[model samples]
Target: MSAKTNEPFTEEQWLKFVQQKQLKFVECQDCHKMSVIPFAVCTTCGSRNITWKQASGQGSIYTYTITAVPPPELQAIAPYVAGVVELQEGLRINGIITGVENVNSYPADLVGKTVSIEFLELDRKSILAFRLNA
Candidate 1:
């Protein structure tokens, strides 16, 4: 099967980005800032000398919102928390936080706490997720 998004990249590339469970980021040779969602050139310094590095998979919740209305496929998973996480490597990514049974009952103090990656399987595709560290 293919990814639901129909991205142009081959399955091998997509699988590498998924099953490998390694968070890949681009480090700008000019600016030295790392970026997620790998690119051909550094978006910050416009340098093509970017290199890939595996992330530590550790991060903190920078901001988030409770998603009440999602796509039909996601409706069954309503009231899920969607948040932007600031990775230890300094890149931010939007992802769903799992393992927290109740979003409302969960303490607001959960923010800024450490989290780690948790790969999720959906519709034959693997997705990257996160959960608060114990």
Candidate 2:
């Protein structure tokens, strides 16, 4: 008997996409506008000539807030920092800021501070995060 093989290509592709730290953005060949999320066709000019490009992985802290009350599963890790970081390439994503011991000590003037990408493990999955670029 032959063994049956099944694998979700899209999911696997997405996993690899995230694991490799490859930031893909859709660039319209016609309008020359880049979008963070990939699309089959460009939303700006309705062009299908969009291509994916890698980002520099550098950004700034747009905004952030601290969460003290986490869900039951995350209760042990309460008092975490979450924020939306605006990438230098013009993409904004929400992620946790690691490497900080005290939330109160977090600098409020982080809006223009440089940051870089970092990954963390949660529930057996890798999550994209950011860290101060000291």
Candidate 3:
């Protein structure tokens, strides 16, 4: 997402993160707790110690759902697929899945299939998406 959103609720840092085309996650320096959300304190230990690390962007589809009737904002891109991806880093993050041509149709075997990062433009926002690793 871009920092120039007409909507005021989106965080600027998240926009910057996408603009950079880098997938990064946070880890507590004190306890090594990992999370995708950027936070000042560790969600596990409540410690202020935190560090950021780039993700490999390599993962597999842990679970997924093909939305046939998307929300109004995404009606233009309806029948899209969203999924919970399990990264090789041992973190699961929600992301869009691309390359599925048929909206009303979907793959029968997406679970455990390899995926790589692919960015797509949505609502003037740069979003992180996943696709077949090949």
Candidate 4:
């Protein structure tokens, strides 16, 4: 079943959508700009007219960095790739890059590589991630 919400979405809501496989982003009705980050007012044009739109789960890696040493809480997934992805809608969002053969030594040609949204189980909770497209 599809999910729906009236209130402005937060990180928690976004995570829920990821778990449900129904990722969504906010689009400003005034400026027509979109953002994966939830906000009560549009950041682009200061408009309150915003609507939620379904994400296509397709994007290209804008940039990335390999986290060789993560925080104490994220030690389980150390040496992970994290980066911003430019979605099909032209908006960028931050997500973990999964399906890497070797986190410690990732390929140099990762920028602009195609990726698809995915849900990963970490610490017994589902989190949003992006898988490299074949």
Candidate 5:
């Protein structure tokens, strides 16, 4: 499967795209709405026509929080930073954040910080992540 197309629209395909470090999203041709996850129909206009669009991987942190205690599956990487990043294309996606020295008492200026999409290999799978821009 190519990273450029959303053929075989499935959550697994979406994860594969993310694993490839490709920031692909489904855009509705009718309403021109974009979503990080692909759907059978556009929720905004009930349109069945959606195309995959690749993002520039550039974005700014919309908000963030330190996960001192993560879920059972992510306990191995506890005390990590995660946040919503607003992409340049006007889409917001949630991803794990990297480059923070200390999750506790992190810098207040983390919000609105520049970031780029990254992939983290964990549990034999690629997890979506973001790298703080220097």
Candidate 6:
């Protein structure tokens, strides 16, 4: 997998959002439904006319997994957690889980737990990540 927004997330446009320090999501122009994952059409209205909106970046860990075998690009930061965060806007997006050096430091379980945004800066590029919320 790549840090650059995956398929359907449209790299150029998605990166623009990330660079702007905004968590962007698609909102159906017709139905006004939000979708964090990029798609060919709105899941609700099946409309192609959708616009990007800035999300509040507050969410909960829908689910998570710690990667013991880090990818080559992130070997230095091995054993990281990655998961889908369900934002306050009612959409879920994938992001790396941060602010933990290991798996056993949680005060509570991650699933359904609250989280906040923490942009990870790597090699002059900014990427979306998360940390446990207070």
Which candidate wins on lDDT?
5
Q: Please report the candidate that would top TM-score against the real structure.
A: 5
User: What ranking emerges by TM-score with the best candidate at the front?
Assistant: 5, 3, 4, 6, 2, 1
**Taking the tens digit of each residue's C-alpha lDDT, what string does model 3 give over 1-134?**
22454322224555577776767787788899887777766768888766667889999999999988788877887788999999999999888988766657566868898899878887787778898775
> Candidate 2, after superposition: displacement of residue 102 in Å?
1.3
Worst 10 residues of 5 by lDDT: 1-10
Kindly give the stretch of ten consecutive residues in candidate 3 with the minimal lDDT sum.
Answer: 1-10
lDDT of 1 by residue, 1-134 (tens): 12343332333554477766656766676789676656556667777665666778889988877777787766766778778889987889888877665776755656787788887777665667788787
Model 2, span 19-124: residue lDDT tens: 7655545566778887665565666777766555566778888987778877775565568777788988788878777655567665455566677888776766
Q: How many backbone clashes does candidate 5 have?
A: 0
Q: What is the C-alpha lDDT of each candidate?
A: 0.71, 0.67, 0.78, 0.80, 0.84, 0.76
Could you tell me every candidate's TM-score relative to the true structure? 0.75, 0.76, 0.80, 0.79, 0.83, 0.77
Task: Give lDDT tens digits, candidate 6, residues 1-134.
Answer: 12343434454666787876778877777888776665557777788776667888899999998787878887866678888999887788899888754464533567987889989888777879988876
Q: What is the Cα-based lDDT of residue 127 in candidate 3?
A: 79
Query: Which residue pairs in candidate 6 have backbone atoms (N, alpha carbon, C) closer than 3 angstroms, thus clashing?
Result: none
Q: How does candidate 4 score on lDDT? A: 0.80
Candidates 2 and 4 compared: the better one by lDDT is 4
- Number of colliding residue pairs in each model: 0, 0, 0, 0, 0, 0
Q: Residues 1-134, candidate 5: write the lDDT tens digits.
A: 23565375566777778878777888888899988878768889998777778888899999999988799878888889989999999999999999887667766678888999898888887888899998
Candidate 6 local lDDT, residue 103: 69
After TM-score superposition, the amount by which residue 4's alpha carbon in candidate 2 deviates from its true location, in angstroms, is: 26
Ranking by lDDT: 5, 4, 3, 6, 1, 2
Q: By TM-score, how accurate is candidate 3?
A: 0.80
